[model samples]
Each structure stands twice: as structure tokens, then as C-alpha cells.
Target: MLYSAKDYQRVRKEKEELDLGRSQFRRDFARLLHSPAFRRLQGKTQLFPGHESDFFRNRLTHSLEVAQIAKGLAQQINKRTPAFKRRSIDLDLVEFAGLAHDLGHPPFGHNGEHALDDCMKKYGGFEGNAQTLRILSRVEKKIQAAIGPSDDICGITPEGIDRRLGLNLTYRSLAAVLKYDNPIPLRRKKDTPLEKGYYESERELVEKIKAHVGVPTASTKFKTVECQIMDIADDIAYSTYDLEDAMKGGFSHPMQLLAKVGDESLLTKLHEKVAKEVPKVTPDEVFAALTDLFMLNGADTPALEQYTTSKMLASDAKMRSEFTSELIGRFMRGVSVTHGTGADIKFSKVEVAREIRIKIESLKHLNFLLMIMSPRLKVVEYRGYEVVKTIFETLDSEEGHLLLPDDLQVMFGRLTDTDSKKRLICDFVAGMTDRYAVEFYSRLRESGASIFKPI
Candidate 1:
């Protein structure tokens, strides 16, 4: 095992009276499963907007699928590798990481994430991954604040001062989700894109988690073997299932992709785009992967009939089920582990083949070009940006403080720093669901509405 028994213990002491026979890892999974942050994922966007159709997946369903894939990948590695067999990976920890991975994504998906990042560029830039760390460490309410006798109690804080321990999760469990260890820059750099990392405010807490997990203070590596498994599982789920959702929503079909695969100009564009990340992935390799997956050459009918017939085939429930299952199995079986030479290292690192990795990336690029970059979706993204910006501006105004929830208003008053106030407002907006954000925006713009209506 990568971690010792002590690493599985929580920072805060467990209640003696409530002690259960369940393992510590299972307890960590249970804590994440019951969190409000996890529940809110149901209303957040995944591929398509959540309110658009019941057919499309929201963040919650995606997380569940990712968890399933993560556990399956862990089992595959455990069965295949001798090192992993000797010191088995914890299935529960892998699942916990996958489930908790996307808990920080704001409403409207990546579009909302970009907008929030842009808004908070000067106040320690926002990123969904960083927000995930924040949620686990300080946003969600699981641990009670350590209080002083004379201090005034506040929302989320039992005492007037913030203690910043949200779930107080076990170090190993927390380490599984610390996908990025670097801190978000306090100032934006010229010509650089916004990136995902932990918040600088939580630097000390991250170090403490690392220490408890037995990671050396001077070690440069951030992710553990379990974290790597979860990351790959996330990629597998995103590439395959998001394509499934897109196909179901009439965005793209395998036959259409088959046709595109043969187009030299389009293939050139795809190669160029993907090579920006993976330079060794050749155009022929991409074409071969697509052809193998879709059986492109086997379709002999006329082009129009092929398009219509392929759409019908794509719409078949049984075919979609089998296709996704096969894809997931193929990817899962590709996982393998490599042991490090050091005598102190107890666990081996996990990896997938380069071909499989590139194939997954190719599928993601196809999804991006066909669904995400579509003009129709861009309109929705634009409107979502306006909604988020408007809400932030409204709450930031002097008189607009009255419109905030009583708890937030109290928090705003208690926090005197400009950056802190902005962060509080950003949190309020970021916590909103897709439908609630629209509803809130509508309520704000209305001429007259029920004064009793709660925000």
C-alpha cells in the first residue's frame, strides 16, 4: 500500500461513540457521497446544459460513471501487476477520488469556469480543480470550527474566525484528489493561459495532508498512484461518455466521423490540433484508430442512405450500451503499473499505453470540434457568461448588499478586505446551479415580484 494506517486517519478525531466497523477508506467515501457539494453536481452541466433535456448527463451522473471506471481500472492493475498484487491499491480510495474530482465545477460547466477565472484573475484566479481542493478543505461543512469563549458565531464558522477545515478528510483520501499541487498565481502573467492548481491560501493544509500521507517534505511529485488511476479514469469517461451524450443529442455520429476521417484537409487540421499536446501522434495513427473503432470501410451503401442508416444505428439503445461498455473495457484493460527502484517506495506507479492515451485525446478533440464549438452552444455559453457577470456586479454594488442572503450579507460585513469580499461574492455565484442561476437572474431583472420569495 502507498499509505500507512495512520495516513487513513482523519485530521479531526472520530467520535468514539459512533465508531463503526467500516474501514477508514470506506468512511471517506461515505463522507464525500453525503456532501452537499456532491448533491449540487446533479444540477450542474456536464456536456450539454442540464435544463436542456433529460437525455443528457449532468455532472453527478458523469462523476458516478468516472467512479465506476476508476474502480474497474484499479482492479485491472491489481490483477495484472505483481507489485500492485503485493501491495494492493484500495478500490474505495480510487472511487472516492473519481466521485469527488468534479465537485468544484461551477454552473454552466467549463464556460462558467472560464468566466469565473477571468473575474477572479487578480484575486487568485479560479479553476475547477482548485475549487475542488477548496471545497474539500474549507467550503463544505463537515468539521466543526474550534471556537473561543467570547467570539461571535458566524455562518459556517462556529466562531467569529474561520478555521478552514471543511471535511477534515483523511490524508490519503485528500491526497487522491489533489490532482494539481501548484498554487494559482496571485497575478496573471502576460501571454499565459489560465491554469488549474490549488489555492495559495490552502498551501499549509496541502503540506499537512502530504506529511500525513508519508510523502517526503522535499519530494517534487504531487500525485499518488491512486490519483493517477483516477485521472486516467476521468479521461476515459469524459472521452467515451461525453461522445455518447453528444451522439444521442444529435450532435455527431460515428458514421459522420468515419466520413470525416477520410478527408485529408480535416485530418490535417485534427493532427495539427492534437499535436499541440501530443506531438508524436501522427495523422495516420489517428485515422487508423478511427477506422478500427468504427469499421469505416465496411459500410458500402450510398452516402445519404449511409448517413440516415448510420443515424438510426447510432440511436439504437442496445448498440450504444454495447459500444460504451466495450470501449471502457478496452481502456481499463490497458492500465499497468511500474515499480520504482527506491527501497522506501512501497507502491508502484500506474500508466496506460501511449496509443490508448492518444486515442482518448482524439475522441476528446472530435467532441470539441463537433459539439462544443458549434455555434448553437456558443450562444448559450455567451448568455451564461453574462448571467454570471451580472450576478457578480449586482452583489458587489453598495445597495445590492441588501439583496444577498442574510448569511452572505453577514459574511460580507464581517470580511473587510476587498479581495475577501470579492471572493465571497464569487463563491455565492459559483455555488449556483444552472436553473437557479437563470431563475435568480430573472428575479433580479423583474419589475415586480413577491417580496416573500426567498433567494
Candidate 2:
């Protein structure tokens, strides 16, 4: 509410200025919306690969859905809570956060992400959230300065030879997507999974963002008010829409999920995952929540029980649609907002009701166990992992720089440092679409090596 002009300050001065009478955040949204990185999301997978069916959610569609949900949440808070009427959340900022949140995700979804992280473990760990920051702050290619000559991105002083300011987005807009505050370590702790933090390359830029937003540099969590809404909106979309996609894919429906196909171990695994998301959640509670959620016959519990043997009735399309819509509406109502104590209203904390939280966690983990962790999808994911790494390795070979495009080749030629050069390779591989990655891998490794057409 107490924002200053610094909140709208760009990391670097614009190379070209055009004032068409748009708000600063509006221009931020336009820059992201029109970028090639955002357009590539149409080719990227969300939960199921786009090849699975035309109806499945992709990254672009998912991000759009998140934006809509986030705007709804912000509007709800602004109108419903009296505290917000005085200092309301900016709808544009929250919507921009929602739309731009997942732009850094690599091809083939998390499968490709894990593969790239494994490839770059020695240089810098790869993460979706972290990549989002990198794409906005450094990678998307909006502004480039005279190399090593003068001012830095934050108008400080240039350090790296590649003096590019991605979209030159505002500090507040950047902070809205700054989900994790920690910097990803070069080498992850032994026996731990990939870390979820920004790269060391963007540390100074992050410091500038936090300082401008009034967040302490020493704070562990740097999530902003807009970020909180976007995070919850992301969860809500993942929980409901993925379930909707699952039903359409015929992977799981009410009857199938309810029965668990009589697999005791599968049921136990689902409960374990649910417990991780919602601590101390019992198996009974998980099933109870699912039962309540998937009861398809509106709130008519007896009717659903009466037709336990009828799979057609359970899988009705109209009923499933109504169920997901109801679930989403209820969860949206669960979000609550509060300001921090003291003279500074610096941060706003958001809390969702435990009931909705349980349902969301339950449904999300259901998809995780039955779909993501399933053997059917695992085979394809394993192949994706191989494709990603093999591509990175081939491109990082002695003469690999020759394979890069003209623009990239120019940058590659400028840098003498090996780490910086290898990072350029990582960035190239990390930006491929699923089909593009496969095609490129086939040309490089398989029988179809091509020199006739441009890659």
C-alpha cells in the first residue's frame, strides 16, 4: 500500500523510450506477454505432455488460468476486506505475477528440469522458480549494453561481459515472482534433491529488489503480497485442473480413485504424499476429503453410494465439470490476508482455511501418485531425461559452439571463461521445447543427422 516510485524502478535504463501513457506494471506485463519465452510455453508440457491429448493443460494455458485465478483473488480481497480498501492490492501486479510465474520452466516439464539441473550441478543448479527470475532479470533479451564499459543492470556497475538486462522489469514485479529467497548452491548437499533458489548470477539484482520492496536482505523468505496470491492461485489451478485433466485422460475417475483398483500399497503411497503436504493427515481423512470432493452427484452422498457399480454415471462429463468448478470456488473463498505488525506495513501474510488446504493437498498428491509417479509416465520421463542431457553434452563438446545460432555464437565467441561459456550452452538446451529437443536429439545421436535444413 505504501509503495514509492522505487518500487516501479527498472534494473537498467531503457535503450529506447516510448511513452504511450501506460502504467509501469502494464508495460511489464506487455514485455513478458510478447516475449519468445512466453510463446514457447505453448509447446511445453504442464502435467501431461501435449501429445497425450488436445485437452490436456500445457504451460501457457496453465499460466493463463493462474492469472485469472490470481486476479480473482486480488479483486476479492480488495472488495471484501475493509483493511484493503484503504491500501488495496494491485490487480495488474498480481495478474502479471500469475502470468509470468512459470515462464522459466524447461521442456518436458519437471522431467526436463531435473535432467538440466543434473547437467548444470557443477555450474549452478537449475530450478523452475529460479529460472523464472533469470529469464526476467537476465535471459529474455530485451536490453543489451556496451560490454564492460559502464553501468550495471541496477545502474550500479557492470561485472559480467554479458551485460544484458532481460526485460528490464520493475523491482516489485520481479519480487512478485521471487518465490524462494535462498541462492542455489553450486553443489547440492549430499543425498538431497535439487534446491529451489535463485542462481548466484542474480544475487545482486535480488538484493536490489528486496531493498526496494522494504524486505530485509537477511530475511530467509522474500515473498511479496502479490507473490502470495500467485502461489495460492498456482496451487488451486494444479489441484483442480489436473484432476479435471486426469478424468478426461481416463487415467482416473471417481470410481477408479475411490477403489484404488484394490492396490493396498498404492493407497498407502498416496496417503504418505498427502501427509507430507498436510502434516498428520490420516488415511481416513484423505479418503474422506476425496469422497466429499468427488461425490459428483452434487452433495447427495446417498445417491453416489447407491450407484457404486455404475462407472458411466460416475464418469459423466457434466458432473465432473460442475464438481471441479465448485471445488475451485470453495477454495478461493478460503484465502485470508493480514498485515505485519509495527510502524511498517511492509509485508502481508496470507492464510488459507485448513479444510480447503486439506482438500487441495489431498487432490494434488492424488495426481502425483497415480499419474506423475506411475510407471506408465515414468518411461517417457526417463527418455526425456536422457534427451536433455545428451543434447547438453553434445553441444558442450570441443566444437559444440559451432552448432549454436549466429546470435549465440557471437556471445560464445566473446567469452573466454569456461564456466561462463558452458553456462551459455546450458541456457540454450534449457530453452528447447519437447518436440524440438527430441528432433535435435535424434539428428545429433540417431540416424537422421541433418545439414540440409537449419536446426
Alpha-carbon TM-score of each model against the true structure: 0.91, 0.91
Off by over 4 Å in 2: 15-19, 146-160, 189-191, 216-220, 261-264, 298-316, 341-346
Candidate 2 overall Cα lDDT vs. reference? 0.81
Model 1: CA > 4 A from native: 16-19, 150-160, 189-192, 216-219, 261-265, 276-279, 296-309, 341-347, 447-449
- Per-candidate clash tally: 0, 1
**What's the C-alpha lDDT at position 193 in model 2?**
81
Which candidate ranks first by lDDT, i.e. highest?
2
State candidate 1's TM-score: 0.91
The per-residue C-alpha lDDT of model 1 at residue 300 equals: 62
Count clashing residue pairs in model 2.
1
